[model samples]
Target chain A: MATRGDSAGMNGGGGVLLLLRKDWSIFTLRHRIFVLTVFLMAALQAVVVDEAYFLLGVALAAALAVYVPVIEWYQGTDPMLHSLPVKRGTVVAARHVVTILGMATAGIVWNTTGRILRPILGGGGSDPAFWMTLEGGLTYSLAVAILALLFFPLYFRFGMGRGIAAFAVMTLVLLAVGYGTAQLAAGPAAPGAVGLITPSSVIGSRVDTLLASVGPAATVTVTLAGMAGAFGISIGLSRRWFATREF
Target chain B: MDAVLELRNVCKTYEGFDLRDVSFALPHGYIMGLIGPNGAGKTTLIKMILNLVRPDSGDIRVFGLDAAEQGASVRARIGFVHEQPTFYEGLPAHRVATTVGPFYPAWDEAEFTALAREFGLPLRRKLKTYSHGMRTRFSLAMALAHGAELLLLDEPSSGLDPVFRRDILGRLSAIIAGGNTSVLFSSHLTSDLDRVADYITFLRDGRLEFTLTKDEVLERYALVKGDMSLLTAENRRLFAGIVTGEFGFVALTTNVEQARTALEGQAIVVDRATLEDVVYFTGRTGEGGLRLNGNTR
Candidate 1:
């Protein structure tokens, strides 16, 4: 073999895009049924119950985000990919890009399905205009992002098995804290407010007051921006962590 | 640039094993067989060369470029075939090729298709469905399809039948016929290496026992057989992995000429040593296994 310096095959810089295409080819189309089932469940729940059925959508999207990485992990081929012409950073980039794309696709599916059903279900646009179909999709995404944003970095850092265990622990800790704070906030209110106190009611009342003060658009904008920033940071962290990792 | 691949003082330490101070060079347009027993650091050394594992401290250069610093570019000119099908098992053979083909800028789809057809691979079947021999064939086809200048194969012929093994070895010989591609083949089957390899690097217990040309190994190493009564203290020092049975004694000597001189006119037999004998004796004795008395080291 002559030195590869003069070789025609050493196209530099496009490894990331090449890796993305390969990963997408293997990962996306194979799970068509799962993606369909998520949307189907979201649609059924929305038509049967209420707009708050987005909670189910959020749960579905989060399940997908968590589960997508596991398939590739189970195949145990990522290390072999490292031996290919692609850079390690390119592998990490492709994974993060695929994950984010899956989330965006889920968001689109959630929004599209809700728009189709809202008229039939008679939502009647009761909330502010900003809380329309797209915002609801964004809310669902942000909720999933809360869990997924924590997951990817863990996956890159500790690998799939240990990372999932760590992610579960972190999720449990966050839920316990959220439950405690909700309990404290839902205690009996002062001076004859005359309302049944519940954790969702307390959080909902706080969100209402905040929306009234800042307007729904502003609140959505800030929340989406925060999630975007966190997602960006998570991407950077995953890339760095995966670069030095060994199979 | 004369050597297609080179390693200098490479070292990697795991929980229970360490590949220490491994250094060798593979000249261009030739085949180098990496032969060692199990856990002999054969796979670990190959992984280090491929940059799949990090070395504690060392330099690995491929095609005269640092394997780590110019890793992507270096790898673009190289093709690797793992011992197992660590591929997307759910995807069909054709899809797996499509998934892997584009990374090589010179990847030839027609070449891959031809190889797949030649190997009798069913394109639509998932890799999970393929047998071990089929997967090995698939891996070789993938490795050969892209006009790779260097091929690093880890046990590529492990589970193959005798006919396919000969066919694969013939293909390897044909590829190197052009004097543009080289191969570093790691295998437990020494008979295969004796058939095609121009150079042999024997590693045992994470340390290299010797890296010699085929002629050099054949010329300098020998297998000796004599009566058990001839097992003198001085004669025993020159033998490694000596076997004594009711029939008599059989041992490996790294210095064929010295053994010939020391026991001239005696009732003993000195015969040419095969690659298998070298690996077997050296591996039987583990590291520092050679009792060459500095003649063949």
Candidate 2:
């Protein structure tokens, strides 16, 4: 004899858990083969090129995180999910939590697999390349998480097809800006500086500076605050947008 | 009898259509059939009740709770079967149940398994592999497994076969027999509703044409067939809609007694209108004159 009051709140903690399970099921059920293929490729890349595995893993995480909501929207399951007893805000919250967990797991797997395979591949143990690759995976994941949090509000507001189109336009603009910045960063004499300025190096240097400047505690606090702020804003926007949506 | 669901002056406007001041009530432990032609806003009204789409004005209450403000809580005691019923297409029925079951506090796994078996749904096969009818049946199975006080089904019989439709209706009747669980399903299949619906709500062009007991609906309208001589300007108003051919004319009337009195000795035959006849004629008329299938006279 379960009553309606059992699962009602701003977050609906119980509802969020159920929604996360359901969302995870939907993700795994629909994309198991693609996931297995991604992992298989990561493993093979780890054996041949250790650095490629981390890049591939980070890319896989972002892709999967975006893919779940995109498919849910495209398939028109959002209406069905909303028709259930779950809070609309809880649904959005559950999805964000699941995405973060999934990406974190992907990063961990990449690091662990690369570490295990490096010794077998006859590489120097604990090399700089290996450490940088692992750290690069984290940096890429964090950046993607921030972008994904922003991207989701669009997806929630406009739905899947238009959301993807918006995402594509945003990606193109970011790429254009990045290219222009790199060209500016490297004057006419240094055409290859774009390649010289690897994402890992820039991201790695930024992390080092931030850590050295403010100490570990401040660095961690700032990181958590940024994530929480993005999450809070994204959830608020999505909830408001979703409430007015006509299904 | 308590109203399990009630909509009071519910109104919603779309780009091309509008649900205008619609209202109805389904008493507890009874089946209410929402009947209308395609694009007549049966689905729209249901969506408003479910809060999938908000009403432009008015209120919907389910089990005495405001539907919009308490949407999540209201939905907890309700089960919905969508028209198309999409799911994780790659997962089997059992797996889907497993994933979705915990959302409902009173979900009964054993009952779900029993219903799945009873519906002849292949538990191991993926939903993508199920036929349209099977998918609908699966939706019905899911709707019944939870201890839902009310079930809202949008065209539950559209993709089902005749036998399955009858079976589903029978099962719904059986559910009502237990003294709980009201059902509100929208469909063009009036015969299925006639078989089991205790209450009937008719929608025409987003307006509530009528909402009454099935007996009252059957009694409230009549079909009249007569000759051209009886098609007088004064007599025409009595007919809700009429169609004329070479020999004579056929018309529908909401008030049979008045129609008989008006057309006395005019060589007219009045008969009880079936639910289909009421839907067809009332929905197929126009201004200026009587409308043929695609013509006006």
Candidate 3:
């Protein structure tokens, strides 16, 4: 049964690309009809909503497509995927690429829909300034990518169910901390203590000023660089964790 | 003959179990059955070979290449079927193959289709809808489609009906007839191996009990039954395990000839040991001492 074929059929880059293609094909087809149904429902609702709110549908579709596949992989495909000749990092990288592509496709659909429906909806359909702004686009992309950086490493480490649970726990902890800090500040007992550590107001003001002062191109570059760094670190941690995993 | 797979002093320790310094080589062109009881490190050993579990020490080689160093290349030559076949819940059967097909160099679509058809797998139905037996059949199809040199199957025949089990055993025999593929079948079903396995590797408590050809094992070990008076301390030393009954006593021994010599001129009967006898006796030895009291019930 051992065929006399080359084991190294693909180089490192080609293998990664092949894995990317595989992930894209599987994820898309697996969620194809659902994505289409969601898109149609959004289109039908476009008459009642503005272009900005309508574009949010893309995120919903993309998130559903990506999340469902991740959950399925946790159900059993992780070992099957790991068993393939591809490296663990390569698998993680390919899935990350698929996630990016799904988001990009969703973004394009949103933009195209906005452009076409602007006239009919009597919405600001073709404002080049709003549509072409790098600030909003890059900031949103960075935010999404950062979330992925956090979520994927956990998913790779503990699988989908535990990863989502951990994420929920972390979110709850942060909210509790935020609420406790607000309560402490509102209490007369800690008014001066709160004034001494008003991090949210100071950080928010500084972040707003910094965004305004930075050029669009510079902001985009910086955000991309940060996302890439975080992604690289996440992939490293994931590969290490996967390598030692007993399953 | 060269070994298709070799493990040298391979060791892996989990929270409660330990596979300590396990070593064996499976020669090419033969079916080697890895037999063990529950929690005997059978699945863990298979997982280690597949690089799913890293060994704490030692080496595993497939096709003369190190598993840890050249894992990807080594794995390309091996097809593995886990106890449970896991896939996307809603994905159709064919899509599962398609998604994985491109990763292997010699993936034959026609072969996969033929095998699927032969196995009666529902190509259009989602995997979640398939029965456990059907999923295993599908897993076997995928394993064969890639033209892998070595097949590592872990507990593959546990939850199947008798007809399907026999069919699977028949197919395994046919696969071995080709003289290129070597299978390492892990199972608790000794009867299935008695029919198909050329070699048997028995494990107990994460240790290798014995690794021998089927004929060699049958010729060596035996089941000896006799009166209780025949049960002496010297005779007890010969038994891998012993159990006393009201009628008489029965025990198993690896050195059947020696046992026969020791019990000569007595009302003792030594019969050829089935693989089942060897498994049960050797498998049950570690618990409550070798001198089992009363009925095994």
Candidate 4:
């Protein structure tokens, strides 16, 4: 016969695992489709578009694909989960871990597919081409990882509906600011610079300069720090919000 | 003589209504029924006990543990069946058991399967497809499989048919026969509780009107019917409420023995009050009036 203490520990661990399994089950259809599409798209892009652009597309697609599960995870059904014997903090942590793992797996598939197709579609017999391709993939992964880590916390804190609105408004503001900065950077000489400037180009430029000026090690450290900070803040907010929730 | 559950001045206030200074205790090895009308704060009180909602004032102790401080630990020993069974709609019955079973250390898969079979539940069918009665049975099966020390049921019989309700009550009686467990159930179905509950707690307008043993409730309150001329000022003062018709007067009295002796000559009939009559009488007149279904006197 299991004692009470033994039961508590067993149930706690089992509850988290069971909940994660349920979450993953719901993600099966959408996640698999998104991963497959990303892989195929990355492979095709490698054969046609610039290698840098192919990796960037893969990164962006992987980041956006995460939204499906994140939104589904926080809907009206969560009250059922809260009713279980699991702690609120554990519930929040488990969700974050699941989302992170899903996004990371998608990122890896995108990067690997890009790598395998790059050589076949290269412009010339450039030396150290594989190393250049690896660098581009890593840079894109780091940028996407940071963006996901930041945006996900907002969703967790405010819920899926409000989170989407907040994300859209923020994206629009960033786009406006990015266009304004590009026109200023062009020093009134470049034609249609405002229309030409994209938010991604501005972000890509800043990231490229930081990588060049401070070396890969420093850039990697800063990116990791940013990821950690975003994750930490999101977890804190989620915990507080869930703790006070009447459900 | 440890109390299995205790609620001390537990008060929860909503925008329009308030559960004011509610207090009660259930000793171990007894079944207590929480009876109330619709929107009488039964669910609110249960939610507070489970720590699903915070109480504005008061303390709840379950199994000698502070309910708020040891909520997770307390909940581990509790089996709850809500009015409407809430489960993963997409999951099958067996899957639902698998997901919730591990949460209780004492969860018995064998017992769960047995009860499911006994209730004629289809383990392979998705919960969304189950009928209301079937869903109630599934919830009861899950609640019982874990050997829970304390069972808290909120309107568990609302959608259940008469036969199924009897089955559920019979199972609960058997479960409580072992002398180590207790149950607190809330229902608007007074007859169901009257059949099983040893103790009854009545709530009205978010306050406890009375909490007494079933025998005591029957003993203390009497239904007296006689001519209206028999209702004297002093006799009417002793009784809680009176219904004076053209020919007779019927009233509910707290002191039945005293009323019987005092009005022996004037009273035409005096009978024991059933639990339904008690609930109906209390509900109609918050002052504990007589519910004259017909002019028997």
What is the i-RMS of every prediction? 5.0, 3.2, 3.5, 3.6
Where does the lowest 10-residue lDDT sum fall in candidate 3 chain B?
Answer: B283-292
Classified by CAPRI criteria, candidate 4 counts as acceptable
Which of candidates 1 and 4 reaches a greater lDDT? 1
Q: In model 4 chain B, which range of ten residues has the least summed lDDT?
A: B283-292
Report residue A217 deviation for candidate 4 (angstroms).
3.1
Q: TM-scores of all models?
A: 0.86, 0.87, 0.84, 0.79
Candidate 1 wrong stretches, greater than 4 Å: A1-13, A28-30, A38-52, A63-68, A115-136, A177-211, A216-221, B283-297
* lDDT for B182 (candidate 2): 96
True contacts kept of each: 0.53, 0.52, 0.53, 0.29
DockQ of each: 0.39, 0.42, 0.39, 0.29
**What tens-digit string does per-residue lDDT give for candidate 1 at A1-247?**
2112222332333665666666566665647776687668657655444435555556556655655467678888866777887776666666666666767776667666766776766664454222243445455555555555788788888889998899899977877676666556656563333344322243345445656788888877876786788678777888788766777
iRMS, model 4 (angstroms) = 3.6
- As a whole number from 0 to 100, the lDDT of residue B11 in candidate 2 is 91
The best candidate by lDDT is 2
Which residue ranges in model 2 land beyond 4 Å of their true spot?
A1-5, A8-11, A27-30, A39-55, A70-75, A114-127, A130-138, A174-205, A215-217, B286-297
Give the C-alpha lDDT of model 1.
0.75
Give a tens-digit lDDT track for model 4, residues A192-213.
7565443235445565677888
DockQ rank order: 2, 3, 1, 4
Predicted candidate 2 versus true structure: per-residue lDDT over B163-278, tens digit per residue = 88888898889889998899998888898898999999999988899999999998988888887678888888888877776667778898999988887777877888888888
Candidate 2 docking band: acceptable
Residue-level lDDT tens digits of model 3 in B179-253: 889999999999999999999998888888888999999998888888877877777788887766665677888
Predicted chain B of candidate 4, TM-score versus the true chain B: 0.91
